[model samples]
Target chain A: MDKKKINCLSSAISIHNLSKTYASGFVALNNIDLEIYHGEIFALLGPNGAGKTTLINIICGIVTPSEGTIMVDGHNTLTAFRAARSRIGLVPQELSTAAFESVLNTVNFSRGLFGKASNPTYIEKILRELSLWDKRHEKIVALSGGMKRRLLIAKALSHEPQILFLDEPSAGVDVKLRRDMWLMVRRLRENGVTIILTTHYIEEAEEMADRIGIINNGEIIMVENKAILMNKLGKKQLALTLQNPLSTLPSELEKFNLSFSDGGKVLIYTYDAQQEQTGIPELLQQLGEHGIDFKDLNTSESSLEDIFVSLVKEK
Target chain B: MNFYAIRAIYIFEMSRTWRTLMQSIASPILSTSLYFVVFGAAIGSRMGEIDGISYGAFIIPGLIMLSLLSESISNAAFGIYFPKFSGTLYEVLSAPISSLEIVMGYVGAAASKSIILGLLILMTAQLFVDYEIMHPLWMITFLILTSITFSLFGFIIGLWADDFQKLQIIPLMVVMPLTFLGGAFYSIDMLPEPWQTLTLFNPVVYLISGFRWSFYGIADVNVAISLGMIFGFMLLCLATIQWIFKTGYRLKT
Candidate 1:
């Protein structure tokens, strides 16, 4: 391989025009195009039936695609599955570890499955990182739900994969454990591992993702840098508390697109977040000039969830 | 198909089978003992000689076949089906192990169990009757071939079955009926002409006849014909199992 090929191989994952239709005629993925960098945390957000798992399944070589192709670490996923899969780790949605096996053996066996020679230290590190080292000798059936979930992460990372796919890692986890998982994900990224995560938790994406992909109905609606996406699509809100309640908006204040709320004691205005100026001062001045008095003022910005819902709705 | 990968899967499966050692070893031994007590002692006393051989000795081959067929099917079926039932099949499917490796591991384990059970029953039958192996080499060959054939059949049953109930259908509905009707207890020649000719269509007859021929040097059907049927069934099973692996039947989707 040449230098360019080596560079491409180091970037972790890429997918182009991938599609899958089940035997039952459900189109699980439709023309997905994506590229994941070597060390960034990428978040995939979608509704219940949005094909997140199917897409992951295709890239991992679990589900054969009806058309198109995917490349993992520059190796074609279908033609060079072993090499491709060796570099990618998958944490499946289902909690399906062997109940009769101990935690340590389960994770170690996963490493051996990848054709890697045994490395006790590597296994220990993974178990310790996932906070499962102490329970390593215990049978899987004896573990709590939270511990089982953590063990899944340990198993996925057992082979020291360059990229890890987490499918709703925190779906049923308590808030504290969820935070711990996020921290572990960050540490993995710092070690030059790429992460692609799917979740219904918008806050998780907002807090962790460097890039966000919004999938709806088997299609990716948008993929953008998190900050830029927020700046471009996020809305800003301006609220003014009235010194006295009113029955309706002032006829002059209507020109500024201001609306009344809180029983007409507050005048609310929404505008683009990316604008050089929101024109909020002019609107407040107009409210004052129109004899609308305010006792206090507050401003807020739209959350990622708001942008997520609006983008999905737009699709 | 890598050697180490095959070894890993084989060893794992063997360990799993060994975990239920008591059931696999004891159940067949105990069942065969009942056959010896009820059929060989009580029934054979009145039945007299069969083809100049003691009635107790005549039933040995059939009893061994019964044990082989039952254990082979259960081992293979439970090996694959339970993994799927517990959702661990997904783990195996997702691993770097190829379909061939998975099949070989499971079928190999099942065949081993069948051979062990067959051998144990043969040894236990000796305690009841003074049976002799007419052709030791043929006996070993038939034992191995039947074990592999039946184990593969069990694998197909595992892949086709969707639930625990579906898994049981083959062992109970198909295997049991065929074994009983296939002349495990009596020679087909003893049946009325029509039933004798009709019994020819049952595949289990070929296996039992071939095994009995190895033991007594006498068979209802030509030994070559029995061997051909066994190999044919073995090939059919291999092809079906290979197809199952290639298409991801029941394992995927």
Candidate 2:
């Protein structure tokens, strides 16, 4: 293999032709081929039951795929399961813990499950980082929801895995926990760990992901650099505040796709921002010709949320 | 063999036993002691001796075996089942540990609990009746073998069951009834005609007869055949577990 091929082969994870069909005949994933680069944060964006969890479970070896192969750092997941699995850590979507177990012991036990020796200092560091050191001796049943979620993260990072998958990390979490989780995720990324997270939270992907892959109905519809995707698909909205509130949009401005908002005090025109001509100039000229006067005007570029909605809605 | 991983699971499970000391350890011991008091002290004294051994002494091994079977299955089954129920099995599944290690961890801890419970019940039984082990080494062998075998059986039940009620069904409905009919309380020799032939077909008879023989130097069946039966059952359970892991039956998709 050439140098570039070697580099691709050395990627954190490479999945080829992966597919899964449940016993009940539901196709959860279909021919998914993906390469996650080392030391990069990759976000899988999908709707509910879009096969995000299925794909992650397959790679984690918790769910068997009906067909295809997966390699983690050049080890085949099926044939070299232990080696492949040793490199990965999965924080599942479920908020599960051994209810009677102390937090410290639980996390320590998780580290040992990966064959790591007991390192109390390292375990302490993780506990402190997650702000769980104070509750280390408490049973899991006594912890609040947010604390339990953090404990899950502590357990995932206990063995210091190179590749981490956070399945819906922010689901049902309070804002503070979500903020802390993102901060910790960024810190992990900075330390050269490859992070893969699945979420329907567009802003999360916009803030944390370097690349975004959109999955829908057991298929990868698109994968692109986060910046490129937003720039390419994002739209711009031109909002004009009218001097007089109109009961309805006049047919004279029908050439422009304009809509009335805020009791007709605002005229909103949405256009593709990526186009060389956004139709703003023509809309303005037409508005002047129609004798429509505006007291104030503002232009806003579409957010990642808008781009994500348009992409999914297009399907 | 990933001893650390095995130790991790084993210790976690063992700690759970400690956390539920009353239910896991005390309850079985207390229940078995009641059997000794009711059957051994009150009824056995009136029933006279069997095969030159006191009736109270005769029932000791069978009573211990009874508790051993039920406790082993329940402990092992519940240990693995709870992880599955709570979704924590995903962590173990995704870890670097192998199937053998997983089995050893859970089955080992569960067998240890049953053995300890069996021993405690023996100590409790001594308070009411005097029973001696004719072959102390063989007695320990049978005790360990029974615990491990039934623990393996329970592990399968844990995997096969999708709900809590299903977990209890086999132990309560199947194993318990089989143990009662397996000559635990009475020897097969006391049965008349075809009943003796039919009792031989019950697998638990061999387990109880073999266990009782280890206590009194006498058995309802040949000692070799009884050992063979238990070992055969062990192999069967082991094979079933191996297949379950290979096909990723309930553990996987």
**Most accurate candidate by DockQ:** 2
Q: Tens-digit lDDT track for model 1 on B1-253?
A: 4445556566666776676778888888989989987889888889978889888888889888888988898889888888888876665666677777777778887898788788888888888778899999999899999998988999899888888898888888888899989988888889998898999999999989999999999898999999999999999998998899788787776
**Chain A in model 2: its TM-score?**
0.93
Worst 10 residues of 2 chain A by lDDT: A1-10
Please give me the DockQ of candidate 2 compared with the native complex: 0.85
- Model 2 agreement with the true structure over B70-101: per-residue lDDT tens digits: 99999999999999998888989999999999
Question: Which sections of candidate 1 miss by over 4 Å?
Answer: A1-11
Largest lDDT belongs to which candidate? 2
lDDT of 1 at A257: 81
Query: Where does candidate 2 stray beyond 4 Å?
Result: A1-10, A245-255
Q: Pick the candidate with the highest TM-score.
A: 2
Count the clashes in each prediction: 0, 0
lDDT of 2 by residue, A190-309 (tens): 898999999978889988998889998899989888877888887789999998888766687787878899999999998887788888888888878877889999999888777777
